[model samples]
Target: MEPSSSPPAITEPAAAGSGEPLAHRRLVFGIVAIALLMASIDQTIVATALNAIRGDLKAELTWSGWTITVYALGQIIVMPLAGRLGDQFGRKKIFLGAAALFTVASLCCSLADNIYLLVVFRAFQAIGGGAFMPTATGIVAEQFGRDRDRAIGMFTSIFPIGGIIGPIIGGIIVTYWSWREIFVVNIPIGLLLIVLGLRFIPSSVPKATSRIDGTGAFLLAVTMLFGMYGISSLGSAGAEPTDPLFIVAMLIALVLGFLFVRHANRYATPFIPISLLRGRGFGAMNTINFLFGAAMLGFGALVPLYAESRYGIPPLQAGTLLTARAVGMICVAGLAVFALRRTGYRAPMIGGFVLVAGGMTLMSLAPHGLTPYAWLAMAAGITGIGMGLSIPASNNASLQLAPDQISAIAGLRGMFRQSGGIVAVSVTTAILNHATDAGTTQAHSFVVFAAILLLMIPITFLVPDHRGTW
Candidate 1:
């Protein structure tokens, strides 16, 4: 494969050197951004609605959490495959198909009458969503042509704002209407993206043909399913640390994953593509991303727990406190574009992690009173800024290493990041469960967790700030 000249940034149709007018080009990218926001927001929206969803379905507490796990597990299995599929076939077709699948699944989720059915539908929804991340990243890269540094920076920043808004919207809808409204919201957004995408998303640049690694895909699926199930089972009453069945299942998953890695290296086209993993900067960025994912989950799970437990707030109020945090994230995410452009990533990554660690640590120190709102707000703002800043740098590093195979590699990165979230939730929940006999214990346990996460700061510097080609 030879390096060809990069295309111009496709801000408008003329910028893309297309026959279309400037208005049409802006219309195209605007629609793509909307589609991207819809998909990313859905990932976080359901977080705030878990309690209502579980109660309505009369699900066991442990089972209700699977609503999150099942969706992520499905994505873990499908993301890598989507990357390769998009690379081999075409990004636009797979993207549209995935969007349609996502819309259908969301409708099914809205209509679900049973907990089991809802979980199944959510899994299907993830299969659709898994494609969106990689394909969207690839599309952004393609649209920007060679000027992807700023484009990637802006692209990465937008999703954090979506993450910020999702919980608030989910909370409002579930509070005023029903949990079903969460899924229903995606319909109009999905339809709009589909129509616009068909009109504007460009054809993929032709590349070397690659075979689909079916065996590797199957093994990867097995690995993720068992791994996620094991994670979900932890911190729950039914799964004991010494349980033989649980131990055996975890061992099996590990064994299969090891085999998959070994086999993938030998294949002509590995499911994960070992070449991507070998890049020093890329590998380090993923490691940091995995840890960051875990920290994000800890914050995600802890915020609601604290709002409800300490403040004696109801689900809606607990969710609203989370909304405050989202508002902070939205404010900071926009600044990230300028930050990445003006200064290099090192200062921001280090500073961001420090802020997150500081914020989490401070939250650990929250007193049992209303006056702490100031401290809470400060913490939320700082953490959000840190997350916003760190994300663009990490994503930029990952893209730099694998420009040609952006979709596939990005998908694999998503799998690791999401898996990190699953693990963090499971492990932190387990720790809290073991440590918390009461409210005080829960608070103390959280402080301990936050302190430990603070230790992850030194590792960030190990990541190289490689600015990959546009």
Candidate 2:
């Protein structure tokens, strides 16, 4: 690491008249928020239509699950590379490129006639979508010269906004129109982001010496692919963890994963710096973000399907189950923005985890005498509140420690979170594919995962938790 004597990347607050106009800064946040919204919406919007998509495209349940998994898979694979590229080529360049790719790919997704084509398009869409967080965050870090904490804390609220809109819009489209409409929805939003981004997003200095680590990236990708295959095997009829395919795939992934880490440790310029993986608070933060992903991306996507299978809820209402969660998040997210400094990171995060666990446990019990929809919605909302309480704290906690490498830190956080989502979706599908009663099995899975989430609480102590900047 650079010696403490080195000048910091960002110095003291800008003078009253030194920075860009306040309105322009607001416009910039608006642009990045909208970009994030479009991508976040895509994440939840498709969940409501999983069954519909499967039926329309004539895909097997296992294959249909790929619609979600592949997107996350694409994201995890591209994120580290995206971070480096942003550093080397300027954040605005990468941001605009990502927005354009996401827009074009969404159009392709809407036009796909087969499941294979749709999945391919979704993966391509993810290539762009995956870059959004790292690049937008770098842009935000530069623009928010002062009150950085408040600005970033507020940024956490944007996802819940997308979370709220995605499922509701998804429900409506899946209920009355074709599922294809979901992807079509992104076209205009993406275009607007691109146009505004081109005109308004300020450019950051590129690091001429930044280098990409192709070897490490390939190993990581291969490892995940093998691991995904192993997980998918468990969903097969009469399959077990010890099945030859599962064992072989997972063992290979394990070996490769080890190698990837070893490579990162030794390489002069690694794909993701080893310190980010194992450095002080960084390692713990990555772990927390990974688990958080299961709560945010995994839980939201599966609820609609769970509600449908378990209670025979219509697509419209089932989709709102996610909305309920987002609503609860909205309730707490605003508070987090203003109150984060007072509560610090650890308290809110641990509390959030407990709430998430409690909410999941609540969802599992549709008691003998209650309305399932109300009960589940309440449960989801509780989970949302838990997430809202923690998100800003977690988002800012890691960045504060490494302000200069904003994009890299943000990308690493995103990679772990998406990795968690991938694992969650994979496990859920694997179980559903083999289960006799999918709904019952899935509900029980929620309780089991909730228990695991609760078990993860002690690890939060390892995370950084100061009231102000690190």
TM-score of each: 0.86, 0.87
lDDT of the candidates, in the order given:
0.71, 0.80
Clash totals for all models, in order? 1, 0
How does model 1 fare in lDDT? Answer: 0.71
- Poorly placed runs, candidate 2 (over 4 Å): 1-23, 48-62, 171-181, 236-239, 309-312, 366-369, 432-443
lDDT of 2: 0.80
Candidate 1 per-residue lDDT over residues 57-162, each given as its tens digit:
9888767777877877888788877877787777777789888998889999999998899999999899998888777766666665555556556666556667
Tens-place lDDT per residue, model 2, 1-470, is 22233222332123112443333566678899888888888876887789999999899986787887788778787776787778767888999999999999999999999999999999999989989988888777667655566777787777778777876788799899989999998899898888888777766677546567889878977887788667756656677777889989999999999999999989998877788887558978888788877655677668888999989999778877877888888889889878877888888888888898899988988655668998988899899899888788888888877776778888888888877876776678777877799899989988877876786688778876778533
For model 2, state the Cα shift of residue 280 in Å.
3.7
- Return the top candidate by lDDT: 2
Worst-scoring 10-residue span by lDDT in model 1: 1-10
By summed lDDT, the worst window of 10 consecutive residues in model 2 runs over: 8-17
| TM-score of model 1 vs. true structure | 0.86
